[model samples]
Target: MSIPSFLKLVEIQTKVASVIPFLLGTAYTLYRFNSFDLKNFILMFISLIAFDMAVTATNNFYDYKNAKKTYGYNYEIHNVIVRSNLKEKTVLGVIFTLVLVAVICGFILFLNTNVFVLILGGISFVVGLTYSAGPIPISRTPLGETFSGIFMGFVIVFISVYIHIYDENIVKLIYNNGILDISIDIIEIIYIFLISLPAVNGIANIMLANNICDIEDDIENRRYTLPIHIGKENALKLFKVLYYAIYIDLIILVIIKILPIYSLFVLLTIMPVINNIQEFNKKQTKKDTFVLAVKNFVIINIVHVISLGIGAFS
Candidate 1:
């Protein structure tokens, strides 16, 4: 495929979803733990991009494969495979190659770290593949937002931090006589997961917004996503609520002493966030205004990252 087609097929622009949290998590590792594993961080970033590309390609490939012309998902505007004249085998090959490379990178990092990394990475792999490749793909369910949010948001952030501290005493893994014993720092993991909810909510809103805009087309294609089961009005209400919850969770993070107080300054982005939300509230069309959600995602997460940076330096 050509450059533009490949980019669109992979939805390269949305890498911000993964990239932002990777940065935020690395920042947290640097500031709070006073640790930075540049080698693992680099490997993790590469693995992340490769896997993200695989996920996007898998989503687009399946959507194209299952698309119904009766619902107007024709080649002219939908399905990069048809629009770019790429063979089905060619797309599948690319997906396989991307996944293979991602797996290799993950394996190297696991070897450099510990079995804990391997187990956690294995969970991410299962969830990532099931997300789009399963007979009943996660995207077709009401739980798409929750799944996408937790995996892409919290899980990645958790993995990023875990890799930097893989040798820490928080988690223990023992292998004897072919039996594996595993232990984890439950409270620490829970703490990060809770603070990570802001990004989780933001990432989920992106999927939620996309589902809301594509509700009719999705139903015509027999994919009953969140908006379809909940109705557009309720979905929109949930959209607004998720964005607002970011601030609520940020406040909780600070009050709990997990996040530095300076990170509370992220609340300053609320005005623009609400403005974008209102614009999306006015129109939910994919062609016209679905980008409001994407824009909101960038604004909220970037501001949060900056807040963390300030705290890191202070």
Candidate 2:
């Protein structure tokens, strides 16, 4: 597999969906907890990128095997496998190798932290695999946005933050006499969730945009996603509404003072984000406007990350 084909197969362009939130968690950890675990962060980033690549690779492999010859499925712009004619064996080998590396890194994180890390990592691992493989892939259902938003967006941030603070007792697990008890810091979890909404909505919007643009093709392909079930018009409406929610979450964080006032600078991206949404609304074509979703994700999250980083310094 060539470098370009490997990048396309892994959807390297979309990795920002994960990268931004991870940085947000890091920034917040710095701001709130005055903590940074470089070793854990490096391990997690390696594991994360590896696992993310594996997920996309497996998904592409799945589509390459099952996709019908529609809008360039087999010829021009279909799965990278067809576009690049990468060997099937090589794809599978790469997927397993990435997954193995990710698992090893995750296990080391567990050793460094606690078993709770393993639990969280395990859930993400299961979801990633179920996303495109097995019967009833999550991507084929209307719940794709929920899974992608929460896990990729929220959960990644949650784990990233927790990795730095595990010793601070966000999770209390006790085992005695074959019985176990657990206590969680609800307030912290809620705070993290609010901080995470910007990324959650941003990432969710990416999938929403894709589903909206592909609604007709999705129907023919039997994907039955949110855009298909609710109809493209409604899906697009949801798409616009979700972008606004990203800012709302940011403003709310400021109001609650969970995030510093400096973070409100991220709100300035609203107009451009809205403009992108409008253009997408005007034309939801994959080739013509799909890049808008990518633009929105990067712009919104990048501004958010920078603002939070500024707050960290402030």
Relative to the true structure, how large is the alpha-carbon lDDT of every model?
0.86, 0.88
TM per candidate comes to 0.95, 0.97
What is the TM-score (0 to 1) of candidate 2? 0.97
Give lDDT tens digits, candidate 2, residues 1-314: 88999999899987888888889899889888989999999989999999999999999898777666445533258578887879999999999999999999999999999989999999999999999999999998999999999998899999999999999988878889999999999999999999998889888888888888777777777788998888888898898888888888888889989998988888788889889988988998778898898898888888777888888887
RMSD to the hidden true structure, all candidates: 1.6, 1.2
- Top candidate (TM-score): 2
Name the lDDT value of residue 186 in candidate 1. 92
Clash pairs (backbone) in predicted model 2: none
Backbone clash count, each prediction separately: 0, 0
Q: Considering every candidate listed, which one attains the maximal lDDT?
A: 2
